[model samples]
Target: MIGSPEHFHQLEKSLARKLGIAAFQSGLQVLRNDRGWRENEISIDYIWMVTIDHSYSGEGGIFAIKYKESKFREKVNPGELVQGIFTNKDEISQIYTETGTTDLRGIFDFNLFEGSQGITLDGVSYTIRISGQNIDTFISLSNPNTDSWKKWEAEIWALGNRMALASGNKEMINLFQ
Candidate 1:
């Protein structure tokens, strides 16, 4: 899809709305410059963290999303797409790069092909992913009517519903609302 950043952002927001996620902002990048870390730009293809309402759990709850392009070094197919779920931002950040900051530390790791796609919190195992190899893949801001776009939307809705049910997070279930 060919579109401006703002248009892409709106598409993401629309997906969030479909999943009943109401409290979300555009994903942003923070880079260190001469003045320290500063906001850079919104992430186009990736949706960042989703905050669970406090009422859903005693402690704060959060989940993050990441889109990984297939890698040749690992023998991953170019057509394969991976979407990861993380318990915290730091975990996701590690896949991209270490932020060199101590503020985020709820750490865990996952490998798609190795079956390492889950985390244990309070002694409960939560499956943290839904992936496919070239399942009509891609969400383009400029091509909303493409087969890839429809497939992505369906998968997102299903995954969101499943996550919300498993986590007992009202916020996730009601995100779009």
Candidate 2:
């Protein structure tokens, strides 16, 4: 999914088409719900920090979609809301504006991961759980019975941050609010 921005765009387009415009629109709004600030004038800068380490093995990155309002407050974790991102284990890393301990080192598979709440990705099923918004975001695939489950923790992690947008139009307004 890296090296080709066009590919990601195409994938996004395909997903939008498959999921439908209304669902996608709702999803985007839901995605924006995680942010603390929102408005009709400001814009949001959603930056995805793509990285990796020894433990986790994926091309996933942290997303920092800024706010688009005059209000400057802390962001919250959206468990089931949010357009393009989710958190099953809200405890894995601090999100929005908390302690700023945004260093994640494990679990790189799905968008959301928690305790016992399983979601399938690339044929592998994972358990996702989140303590709450701006709380514990965790994902566990630990099951001695299966090989896939054993190496789940050190493969995926989802973290997010926020900033602020200064300008945009009506159509672009819906982007990173």
**Top lDDT model:** 1
lDDT of 2 by residue, 71-151 (tens): 224544332212232211211121122223332323334333333445434322233333222333333333323334444
lDDT of each: 0.31, 0.28
Off by over 4 Å in 2: 10-42, 49-56, 70-177
Model 1 stretches with alpha carbons more than 4 Å out: 1-143
lDDT of 1 by residue, 52-96 (tens): 222222111233434233433334323221232222221221111
Overall local distance difference test of candidate 1: 0.31
Q: After superposition, how far is residue 29 of candidate 1 from its true place, in Å?
A: 15
Model 1 pairs in collision: 1-142, 1-143, 2-142, 20-174, 20-175, 20-176, 21-175, 21-176, 22-175
